[model samples]
Target: MLETLVKNSRTSVDAGVYEIRGAARGGRSIKWKEGRAALITEVKLASPSAGWIREGADPEEIAASMVRGGADALSVLTQPLLFHGSPEYFARVRRSVDVPMIMKDIIVDEAQVAAAEALGADYMLLIQSVFDGGYAHNMDEFIEMGHNRGVRTLLEVHTAAEFERAQNTEADLIGINNRNLDTLEIDLGTTEEILAGRNTRSRVISESGIKSAADIARLKKAGAAGFLVGSGIMGGRDIEGTVREMISAC
Candidate 1:
């Protein structure tokens, strides 16, 4: 799955101006303010594990609803093969809302970093396992590229080892993803288990398996600084209300 995602990411990269610019919304740190945990919602159309999530809904509408519900930020999936996401979707959502936005993709190549900058993403998700797999450039190189483009990085890790390595990087946010990308399995406790030893939780954002306010309360008790929810909000009957309820947990 990782190999396929990397190949898909590489094949999709296109040349661009790669212009250097300052942070559009004050450095991706805008998601966390007043010392309160944030609700980072997502515009996920589908996933390899769940398949066709809101297969026909407009990305702009989904993002607008999330903003209406007071989402602290938005995550736009950019992978196209299995996830059914595209950079165009990110661009559409980028134009629709003002909340801090993240370009969520299996980024292994530097061109993806340029794409994130061109799309005006405040932050780009960098998975540690991708570097651990030796698929492309390491996290440090991508993080530097993103910094040069004035795009922050959300370093996502799925294991204790990866989390440890993530702690040593200059990533702006540390994301603990509960879902196992390769096996398509999810365990919400993954966040708690990984963050148990950390002293500061201010920059920790828990991802995956985040469905309800109860899940939010549980993770909050475990010291997660933000929640990156996708399928839960997208799959709900009411996207706006769902996001509101989740934010209410904080």
Candidate 2:
């Protein structure tokens, strides 16, 4: 999956699918409202594991619903092939919502960073494995690129080693993703297991497999300061109410 995702990213970069904007408006801070219940709702359509998770849903509507449910920020999947995502979706949702957004792509190149800036995104997702596995530029370099382009970096780590390395960077947020990219599996305890006995000053956002307020509360006890929920809200029968319930839990 990583190989194919990287290939697709490189293809997009080579074809100049992402544009670099000259000037960008400032991005909203992830720490909009304090408390353990900070939420970053996502606008995702599909994924390799969950095919067609929310097909035919408008990005603008999803984003608005997330905000109405008290989302501090938003995340939009922009990978074209495996995730069935597009930069266009990011742009549409970005224009419709006032909250901060993170462009959730595999991000194998600096070009993607520029693209995020062009779309008015406040943050861009940077995979620790993608950089650690020699698939792209150094994580520091990518973080710097994001800074230079007027967007913050959200360093995503799945393992203990990656989490350890993430704290060393200047990224604005460290996402402990429950979904392992290599295995395509989901574990709600990934946040708890990874954060056990670890004191981190960096902002840690638990990603994936978050379903209800209980899930948020458990992750909060695990030392997660924030939550990035996708399918949990997008797949729900009532998006706004689902987000509201989960947001209130933490």
The TM-scores, one per candidate, come to 0.92, 0.95
TM-score of 2: 0.95
RMSD of each: 2.8, 1.5
Question: lDDT score of model 1?
Answer: 0.85
Best by TM-score: 2
lDDT score for candidate 2 against the true structure: 0.86
Write model 1 residue lDDT over 1-250, tens digit each, in one string: 7788777777666432233344234255454567578999999999888899998899999999999999999999988878888878888888778888998988877767877887889999999998999987667988999999889999999998988888889998999999998887999989999888678533889999999999999999998989999999999989999989998897
RMSD of 1: 2.8
lDDT per residue as tens, model 2, 1-250: 7777788888877877676545346477776455555898988888788899888988898888889988888999888777888888888787687788898998887778878888888999999999889898678988988898789988999999999999999999899999988888999889999999998968899999998899999999899999999988888879999989987887
